[model samples]
Target: MSAADVWPIVKARLELLDDARKPLIETYIAEIEHRMKHYCNIRALPDNLLYVWASMTVDAVRVDLPNADEIADTVGGGANIKVGDTSVSGGSSGSGVTNTSKAVIDQVVLDYRVDLNRYRQMRWGG
Candidate 1:
């Protein structure tokens, strides 16, 4: 199946977004399809699972894109920067801020079983 087939379910899962956001969502869907292709043949997977993954990936992307500016700033100089009276120094050890949405997406990608070893084991015998 294609992202176009995944679009309706993705849209249904999301909150009301403006028409301007439509293109962004499309872009995200395209990205998902591209990324999934590298791991395994998405078209080979069940349509139901594809719908679930597409819906989830779109949500993750939706949450992540808005934080793009904040993420960039944090990577740039956020550790040294202070917010209002609170010091937002990224954290001790300078690991920088965590992108939770990205973490979720990464986990989801694993759930999709894109790894060569895992995918092969899943598709074939142990």
Candidate 2:
């Protein structure tokens, strides 16, 4: 699969990864980048693309991926974002959001999805 196509799923997986284990996720990426050309016959993307893909992955998984700390900064003080359910409030720190906020956010949902075809086109240029 093209790197672009795989980015969405990778982001989702990384989001689910434990906060402490996120660093290791970078390791997986280096190898994936290397193999995208050799193993998967994908065109080699510039390092910028790799970074962009990684960033996109983190976002898809519903987490902040600021360059300030890479994976370390990913897990912020805010409540964890569940795949299908997400809530936002002024205060990230609180008792699981106020009853009123909960009611409002209950209607908010983020469905995780990945499109591999996009990656294929970007990688194979077909």
- TM-score winner among the candidates? 1
RMSD values for the candidates in order, in angstroms, are: 9.8, 11.4
1-126, model 2: which lDDT tens digit per residue? 355455445656444443463444444454445533443344665453554445434443233222223333345544355323433322233324223322222222112113222343434555
- Residue 11 of model 2 has an lDDT of 51
Clashing pairs in 2: 5-119, 11-57
Which stretches in model 2 have alpha-carbon errors above 4 Å? 1-25, 31-41, 46-48, 56-73, 83-126
lDDT of 1 at 21: 55
Best by lDDT: 1
Clashes of 2: 2
Tell how far residue 46 is off in model 2, in angstroms.
4.4
| Candidate 2 minimal-lDDT segment of 10 residues | 104-113
